[model samples]
Target: MSEMFQTYERQYQELVSGLKQGCVAAGALNEDQRRPKVPELKTALDEGDSLIRRMDLEARGLQPPQKTAFLGKLKNYKAELTNLKREVKMMSMGAGAREQLLEGGQFTTSQEQRVQLAAATDRMYQTGDRIREGKKVLVETEELGVSILQDLHRQREVLQHSKNTLHGVDDNIARGKVIIHNISRRITRNKYIMAGLIIFLLLAILVIATGKRHQG
Candidate 1:
């Protein structure tokens, strides 16, 4: 059980690390795109993807009971990773579409390409807003995760202490049973010895009384 719990702890830490890294990477990607930062954005994206995959694989290897809770946390982190990926995709696509519309030399208001560009920009803005909200949520979840980890630590400590205490109680019960058995045996031996002594005394008195009657 301790081994299982350790496995869970390792997995939990990985998931938390993944969540924080992914959020940070997502923000970096957005900042890069906004400021025309190159290669660094791509580098950050690659690193984030690798970390996310590693954490996911680790999470999948966890065993039962602890696995249930571990998996739940992994799922939540996976969702966050997916959101980050989607946000990146949308931003990249929107940028490409905007560039294409500008290069086509068609500035007409009703042009199909123009409309698509507008729609893409709107999506980009929405994605940005969503990422902002997600960052806030991630911040709040970080605090919550810390509190939860602390709670788990304290709770496990209590459980171990309780288990040790119960083991002591079990040992005491077995010892008490043996002691009681010995005491009962001694009581039985005393009763038999006393009964035999009483019987011998009564027989001797009866014999003496018969002799006295014959003599008188």
Candidate 2:
């Protein structure tokens, strides 16, 4: 994508250079010679316009960061194209005026040309407006996507914390079981000791009573 952008950038620069050269060359020519140059300049301008639109579309398709990076350059290209249009318009007007002067004000072709140029300029402005709106939408969408990813990240953290808490609880339960088992063993041993003591006392009492009866 970067390479493609660079390629477009290079082409646009070349086109602009050629256009400027053409404008200069036309300016140095006689009206008759410059007459043919206007159409050629208009063709270059059209090609540049199309190329810029293509660049805009390509920029739109890029990632947010990449799009951001290209924005300045894109704006610069747009400015350049606008300047080229103005130059072409001025050249056309100059030629038309010279022809009208030479023909004693009988040139209606320039008026029609002006109207067409105005319409084309209006369309260019409308296209620019649409491109701006599209950029706004794209920014909003990128922000929404970032927000969603953050929410997902937070939820993942919560889930991981819950799993760790459950593991701790399991550990505590296992410890409790071991403690209860040890206590139960201690209680059984104590009961056995008490039984042995009781048996010893009973045997002593029997022996004493038997001896007493023999003496009597």
Candidate 3:
């Protein structure tokens, strides 16, 4: 029973850590940053959940799983996971809000909303230029339309790459700060230890000198 409990706790912690990473990845995606590791994160989350479930079954004869500490934590983790899943959904939505203009009643993330606006602009431009010329306009516009869509897609790709680079820089800066902080802490501790050692050495010398004088 104790061993099963230990396994459940370890699985639970792993799940929590994975969820945190997923949540960060989701947030980074919200910034239109590409997250290529989302699939692996999903796998980790699934594996963690499965491990907990397996442990639950294993402890059936030895203990009551429901009343165990693991269940309580698992429930909390589920709630956190629910919120994280919503964040992930919103990240994909890209544009989300109340808009009567949407033929489909749904919210989209801000990025999708921008893309929708761009599409609307394209449609409007095509409608206005339709009467200017016949075949030339049709051919020119067709090529131009394809070109515009391609450019937009390419621009988004570039922006996502830039965002990812920026995120990397930010993470590096954060890690640097932690490293500096840890170094400072260690230096301070070393200073205190050295001072204590020096004081002890001085006291020992004084004690030996006093003993010699008393002997004299």
Candidate 4:
């Protein structure tokens, strides 16, 4: 269990790092959802989540199979983060108080109130509650890290089987892309060949006609 906690602690630290980066990146994204840059930022954020999920798997010693599930969850979280970031940005723009719809009133910018509530939530609140959902997620992520280590201890063979399945799918997709690219190249080559042959035949006919006219 000590090993598990160690793994969990490492993963937690990595997640905190990612969260800090995410906050900074969130500021780089457009404040308005209507902007074209918003989608680009969203895509970047989604890709970031993918990186984080893969990193988490490496941290947990879970290997590969679970990576897909975590990736799926990461994608979901990316969507959530995008929405949250967009809302937060909108709030920054002096929009109305009800963008989030989480609580009845608009969120106040009183840094003291925000700090005190945050402290209270950290100290006395159940991590699972809606008010402290982020904390709950962090704790659960640690539990997942421990669970993954234990799983590796007991059911590694089964986990590897899952890993193989996912890897197979990933390989097939890569192979499919290569095949499609080759087919496209072949079709283009054939088109050029056909065009070249048509031009050659036309030139030959013209030469023969000129010789016959000269002989006449």
Which candidate ranks first by TM-score, i.e. highest?
A: 2
Please name the candidate that would achieve the greatest lDDT relative to the true structure.
2
Candidate 2 has an lDDT of 0.77
- Order of models, best TM-score first: 2, 3, 1, 4
Q: Mind giving the per-residue lDDT tens digits that candidate 1 earns over 98-131?
A: 6677788767766776567557656765676576
Worst 10 residues of 4 by lDDT: 93-102
Clashes of 1: 0
Residue range 58-111, candidate 4, lDDT tens digits: 544544566455545555555665665565355344223223333446545774
Give the worst 10-residue stretch by lDDT in candidate 3: 92-101
Candidates' TM-scores? 0.36, 0.49, 0.38, 0.27
The count of backbone overlaps in candidate 3 is 8
lDDT of 3 by residue, 163-210 (tens): 999999999999999999999999999999999999999999999999
Task: Choose 3 or 4, whichever is better by TM-score.
Answer: 3
Q: Which whole-number lDDT from 0 to 100 does residue 48 have in model 1?
A: 46
Candidate 3: global Cα-lDDT? 0.63
Evaluate all candidate structures by whole-model CA lDDT and list the values in order.
0.62, 0.77, 0.63, 0.56
RMSD of each: 12.0, 9.7, 28.1, 25.8
Rank by lDDT (best first) = 2, 3, 1, 4
Q: In model 4, which regions exceed 4 Å deviation? A: 1-159
